[model samples]
Target: MQKTEKPFVEVNNLYKVYDGFSSVLDNVSLEIARGEIACIFGPNGCGKTTLLKIIAGIDKDYQGKVLIGGKSPIEVRTGIVPQDYDMTLLPWRNTVDNITLPLEVNGYSRRVLREIVVEFLKKMGIKLPLLSPVYKLSGGQKQLTVIARTLINKPEFLVMDEPFASLDSSHFFQIADVLKRIWNLTEVSTVLVTHDLVTAVLLSDQIFLFSPKPGRIVHCEKISLPEPRSVSDPLFVETVNYLQGVFLMGGE
Candidate 1:
């Protein structure tokens, strides 16, 4: 018999209330295996972001338990990529500067930072204008910079909330490709929050669908489609459609 591995992340009976009265999350519970990617999918205002925050150890005022690697979130190394890149990246900083921001405070020399960013980007098969101000980069480039910065620390877990929310189809797929490559290389346990079902199916090993306000996981679907998934593939289309139907039914 094979030994069972413990979950890398665990959220049990989670609950979040604001102002001590407004409930946002209700009895939420989940478990993620090491190196697996999990996505929280739901309609807007369904407390998806709130859940991500809890897991990321940003919002700690909630009730219940969330553990990463058998440790509290604050005790774990975490990287966060928020939905808003425009606000996250400093406009005055260049690409390389932005990518190395997370580790700069450690007193590393500029040459070391540049070399680190260059080597990391090379490994990820990503290319960017090292000296170009982030404000001048495209939407995809900005998001890429943010992701690079987040991963520079090589945290135990990656948390992203709607990272591609603002991109067009072209940029959306581009960013998705980059993210897939990164995950394949790092196999880092991740929790991503998104309203896009296609993204959830394409990027995650499992998708957790949440109900409306006072969110709860109504369904958990495992995605078995092979990599390089397409929106037009029959099975891919079927899975997306099935999830859509599930959502519709939940709404009804």
Candidate 2:
């Protein structure tokens, strides 16, 4: 018998209700292939973060099946980067210390973990102010530190919620380029939540559009643009405009 292939990540009939009244997500289903970067784009209150929380094993009240590599989210090696970089990062910890924090949890010595962080930064081509405390870093630098900390453990599935939400245009593109570099280096399957159509077009292999509250998968767009994409490219602009039109038309 031929083997049946399964998706790397699967969400089937997902429904989330708060206090048995508020319906956040309804009958949401989607499949993500291994090593692909998928973006979740939707209006505010459409349960994008709820879905991400469910996938990250942070929220367990929802009713539905969410699987990562045919196992529950808790069973997988998952890394999560929340939108609030400032709140999540340790203000007292410097860049290397913060990046090594996860390893420290597993009883790794600080010296060893610092070596690992150094190697990881080298591999990812990332340079940070290693001695500066996270609170002293700029917004972009803080976000990059959070990302580096999450990625240091080499997670099998990565979940990022609006990673670029806090950056200005210059830092936004800088971080976006870093993300592309990370994808090239690790190819870690990622589910990123973002409100920006341009970001979705630039980073995702598949873009999942959700409806307003009681969110469902309204559309799943495949982005076939070549890697190292540029906003100046005509096709890239066209794709962003098209997605914007869809949003303006209320996902019609």
Candidate 3:
């Protein structure tokens, strides 16, 4: 972003250490412009999720400044979708009930909450057995249910940690499409952490590439390819290849 344009989410000079040993994230700094979709891609244990935890207010035992829309994450409206979305669902609660828990607690009449949830699901084209217990649903369905639950509150921003990690290649693309759909429709600023370079290339407006453990930003580049990206598209392939090189260099 330009000097005059302020970021909606900003992290500056972050440092994190676990068990008072070595650093997890060292001197990490990055920014996300409002409504931009940025991806943080790196190898496992590179402090990707650790960085997100700090930004989400889930882990404050760190040294850094994490600001969301000029306020700390605790002071702003944000939702997190972890990789273990299936585990996050209420096993005893049926699909609809689990997704609507937030609304239910807010005192929306049962009838009203049901109507609202149905409408939201319809918009997303997600059709699941309303009364089916979450454990009975398929993996993809569970992920969808988690996304629905997260969206029910209509967060201004979203932080996703390898949300598609559990899926196979086919499911990966399927969920990736679902994510892109919501992203374009809602225009919500999102920070997605993923290990898949292809997924990042296809989805990100820009990418914040990290080095190995004790992670730090090694490359932050704007993805100039147009959307509705296809694997066969030359620009898409070129961009992916370019990012592959970036990642390779970062690991060296």
Candidate 4:
């Protein structure tokens, strides 16, 4: 494989504390290469969400330098899909309106926004007719709508926090495939935070393993499974097993 350029996202000496009782993230550092799908995996309460929030600019009180394309996180034009759909998507708006809200807020012309929204709806497998009234849509549809919203802006960096946690296995893989296809199509750097090991193995080019509270990155493994990897492949199973071992044996 050809070596890529420097990381599009980098976190150095990151630390987060709440109530001064304990640090959620302690001197954690990571790098995500351009066009790579990087996954952050760890036990619950391991500060994975906190780290992603800081990177997404949702939480700014932490101590660290998060750089996106060599600029501060706030300086980079990026998109974020939060773990909670309710937090990221407006309940009152219909799917299309929700997806296009970002573009409208960013001052895109109506015609331009319409064009982008149409393409993203198609990409997300959301039909135009079903775009009305988020409450009318199924859970899976709502999640896809949020993804479409994130992609509609054509961000250089995309951050997803357990976006598939609520989906059934079938829906999860379908969404995962859609995400992979979109990443290939856009070549955008992505960071996905999930507790699901299988999902991480399926979607990531690199995996970052974190330890429990007072979290710190213990391992950074470059996934070498061949492209178009099938979950049934023996090599894929072997890779997953090895990753599980790495996670079980966390080190500083």
| Candidate number of the best lDDT | 1
Residue pairs in collision within model 4 = none
- What ordering of candidates by lDDT runs from best to worst? 1, 2, 3, 4
Candidate 4 per-residue lDDT over residues 36-97, each given as its tens digit:
89999999999999998888877888888888899878777779988878777788887777
CA shift of 2, model 4, Å: 12
Q: Which ten residues in a row have the lowest lDDT in candidate 4?
A: 122-131
lDDT of 3 by residue, 98-143 (tens): 9898776689888899889999989987778888999988888888
How high is the lDDT of residue 123 in model 4? 65
Can you list the residue pairs that collide in candidate 2? none
CA lDDT of every candidate: 0.91, 0.90, 0.87, 0.84
Q: What's the lDDT of the predicted structure labeled candidate 3?
A: 0.87
Per-residue CA lDDT of candidate 1, range 57-167, in tens?
A: 899888898999999998888999999999999888888999999888788999998999999999998878889999899988888899999998898999999998988
What are the per-model C-alpha RMSD values against the true structure? Answer: 1.7, 1.9, 1.5, 2.2
Q: Report the CA-based lDDT of candidate 4 relative to the real structure.
A: 0.84
The alpha-carbon root-mean-square deviation between model 2 and the true structure, to one decimal in Å, is 1.9
- How many clashes show up in model 3? 0
Models ranked on TM-score: 1, 2, 3, 4
